[model samples]
Target chain A: MDYFRQAWAIAWKDILSELRTRQMISSVLLFCLLVMVIFSFTFDPGAEYVSELVPGILWVAFCFAGTLGLERSWGAEQENRAVDGLLLSPMDRSAIFLGKALGNLVFMLAVELVTFPLAAVLFGVSFLDVWGKVALVAVLATAGFMAVGTLLSAITVNTKLREILLPILLFPILVPVILAAVKSTGSLLQGEGWEGISSWVKLLAAFDVIFITVAILTFEYVVEE
Target chain B: MEPSLRRNLLGLATFMMIEAAIFMIFIWAPTEQVMGIVQRIFYFHVSCGMTTFLAFFIVFLASILYLWKKDKKWDIVAHASAELGVLFCTLVLLSGPIWARPIWGTWWTWDARLTTSLVLWLIYVAYLMLRSASRGSERRTRFAAVFGIVGFVDVPLVYLSIHWWRTIHPVVIKPSGIGLAPPMLYTFLVSWAAITILYFYLLGLRIRIGKLSEGVEELKAIQYSGV
Candidate 1:
């Protein structure tokens, strides 16, 4: 209970700060919008094939924007040396990881909330009928992405390349998440129902569980002085 | 034994093994009725693949040890192993396409094994880049170790996801294990043994280079400190 409270407190700190400024969220949202616009230009928006392309475009937007936001996730901590202070406090390092990952998930979900509907509007493909299923896949896949992203964010924060190194280190490990998410989303958009996506859903869930557990175990080593 | 003498013996043994493997692969092994001469690439290609996995497994183990013990030696081993892993993985990637062009009729297909190997190659290549980008700090060592662990842990997941993804698409070639005849089997074993020794030899050489560079850095530090 105490651990959960501590983790929540850390997460709340990020939320409070973002609420005050709204810098990272706004930029990430704009980037997501831009991705959709650019991708739309590549294909005829009214073409029959547009539905098949919608899921891939939406995910590409989310991933690129998520990468942008995650790059900033650790920026403030590193700049202010706040991470060292957090380390000095009487909290478990794994708590810090959980808290940061939670904060990232919430921020990413906020961006996706707008990006999804806007994508549907711009691409002229309505997934409103299957909105629930799409959202579930989005959250599951994003959870897995954050689980790994937050840890890699921490690792890359210490590197000389900084933000440049995060995606290079991140995307390869993220192959499974991207594959499962895109495939499931593509199927869901086609109205294949749960039967079509069950295996992929299971893959996403397994990836989330495995990575979150691994990140928790390895987080301490990344943050140790 | 003296270090130089040991290295010489390793070199000699590796040389002999390579000679034997070449003879067995080209002469001793009978030509396949189907793949014919092109099948010969299979021995070296498979051997390189095995070595790549072994090298990565070493990187994973050494990385865990480095983090647990906080030893510089283990860090050096991990770094060296990752570099060698990338080398062997590149060989696998290169050889796959070369063999595939004539056999599979295309230079590349999204086959399960092929896709998995490509993902693995990208992951370790990133690992190498991370090491180079963050060169000197102890913090860099810890960061690399963390990635090393995460990258390795993701491999099975990558393979599983790609395998499923491939099944959904039309598979150009059904990936099946080749049943090697007796001579082909002996040839493969010898080639595999040769490549494994080559991996060890390169690992040792790279580790020594790593140690020497560390020594040079220490000497430079002492000179600057004017103690």
Candidate 2:
């Protein structure tokens, strides 16, 4: 109960600050919107290519935008030296990781909420029909992304070339998450329903579980001096 | 065995084995009825692929040991293993295309093995970059050890997730596996053994060099400080 409370407290700390400033989500949403618009040119509405390209565009937008958000989130912590205070708090380190990851997930999902509709408009597709499945896929994929990204963001926050290093360190281990997400998104966009995408969902879920566990267990070492 | 003598023996043994393997490969292994001379690239290509995995597996074990013991030696081993893994993975990525351009008739395809290996290669390259980025801080080793462990864990998941799809790439080892003809199978085994020796030799040399450099740096620091 106390563990949950501490995790919630840490998450609340992020959420409250985010609500006040609005910087992280705004930049992420705007960047994603830009990517969607530029990519939509190739995706010409109602073209045979648009349907095929939508999945790739959507995921690339999210992952790229998500990297920006992750950098900001961890960067703020590192720059302010707040992580040291958190480390010294005598709280459970895993709780700290969970809290931060949860905060990242929420912010990413909020950005995705705005990005999806804008994507539909630019690409001239009606997401109303499959928004639920799309949302499900996005949520699962986002969890995997944030789980790994949050951990790596911390890992790289103290590095010499963190901006470039973050994506380099991230995108490779993230290949599976991106693959499953893109595959599942392709299926959802095709209107194939759950049966067509179950394997990918399982892969995403498995990746989420594996990565979250690894991240939490290893978070201590990553954050420790 | 004495260190230099063992190394000399290893050097001689590696040369003899590689010589024999090369002979078996070029002479003993029969040409395939289908792909012909170009198919022989499979001998070294697949060997590099298998050894890449072995190198990464050592990295995984060494990484865990590094984290558990917090010993710098384990960190060195993990770093060395990752370095060799990346080297061999590059070989896999390179030789793959050479073999594929002739066989698959294209420079590349998004086949599962190829894609997974590409990701694996990228992950370790990132690992090496992270190691390089970690300078003059205790955090460097700890950060790298954790990253190494996580990267190692990701390799199999990357393989399985990517392989979950219907890949056009041939599944060489299948459910009804071990389908190699006698000569091809023997050539593969010999190549695998020779490469394994080469891998250990490289790993040993890298670790020794790492320790020597660490000593040199320590001496330099001491000389400068007049301690």
Candidate 3:
């Protein structure tokens, strides 16, 4: 109960702070839009190409844009040097990790929500048929991404070259998420349904569970002095 | 035994074994059924690939142990292992393409093994970059350890996801008999053993260099400030 409360408090802190500024969301949203617009121009693949490649394109956007959001997720705490204050509080450090990760997830999901609809418009595809499946993939993949992302963000946050450092550390470790999500989403977009993507879904789930648990357990060391 | 004597013996053993492996590969082993001479590269390529994985696994274990014990030696081992892993992974990636160009009729394909090995290489490169980017010794060591652990945990998942993602790709390796003739099998085993020894030989050199550099740094600190 106390852990939940503590985590919720930290998450709410991030949310309320973001609501005040809206900086992270707008930048990430715009970045996603720009990526979509740019990639759409590179190849005017017929309906076949779009179906085959849209998932990879969308994931690429999310990967690039998601980094922007994650980079700023801990920006406020870092800028204020409030991690020490949070660490000093009697609450478990894992709670803080959970709260921050939850908060990042919420922000990331919001970006994806808008990105999906906009991508549908920009690319001229019907997302209604597979929205649910796509959303499931998004949720799982994004959680896995931010699980390691948030942890690495905390590690890199104190560094001078954090912006470059985050993606280098995050992306290579994220190959599985990208592979599973893009593969699964590709099948979903092509109307293959859940039957086709079950294996990928399992991989995504395994990745999410393993990484989230690890990030929660090990995050204390990342923030300690 | 004295350190130098042990090192000399180890060096001699590694050199002789490597020479034997080469001789066995070219002179002793029968030509492979399908791929002919191109198949010969598979011996060292596959061994290096496996060695890279082994090296990174050492980094993983060292990372966990470092965090558990808060020891500097584990950090050094983790760093040394990552350095070697990256080198071996580079060879794996390079040799994959060279071998592929001849056998697979293409320089590269999105084959699962190749894709995952490239990712493995990138992850350890990130590990090295992370080590160099951070300044504080304690913070640097801790960050590298955590990243090392996380990167390793991703490795199996990387393999599984890539495996599931594709079915048409050629299977590059199998532990049990997909069928290698007796002499080919013996040469493969010998090459693997030689590479494994080479890994340890390089590891001892790398770790000692790391320690020597640290000692020099300490000496400089003592000279500059009143240690």
Clashes of each: 0, 0, 0
Docking class of 1: high
**Chain A of candidate 2: what's the TM-score?**
0.96
Error of 3 at B89 (Å): 1.0
Model 2 CA deviation exceeding 4 Å by range: A43-46
Docking class of 2: medium
Higher-TM-score candidate of 1 and 3: 3
Q: What is the TM-score of each predicted model, taking all chains together?
A: 0.95, 0.97, 0.96
Backbone clash pairs for candidate 3 read: none
Q: Candidate 1 lDDT, tens digit per residue, A11-120?
A: 89999999999988988888888888898789876899988888888888888889888888888898779988889979899999999999999999999988888988
Sort all candidates by DockQ, best to worst.
1, 2, 3
The collision pairs in model 1 are none
What's model 2's lDDT at B109? Answer: 92
Order the candidates by lDDT, highest first. 1, 3, 2
List, residue by residue over B100-210, the lDDT tens digit for candidate 2: 897899989988889988889998999889988975646888888888888888887788887886477766667887778988999989998998899888888899998
User: What fnat does each of the candidate structures reach?
Assistant: 0.83, 0.81, 0.74
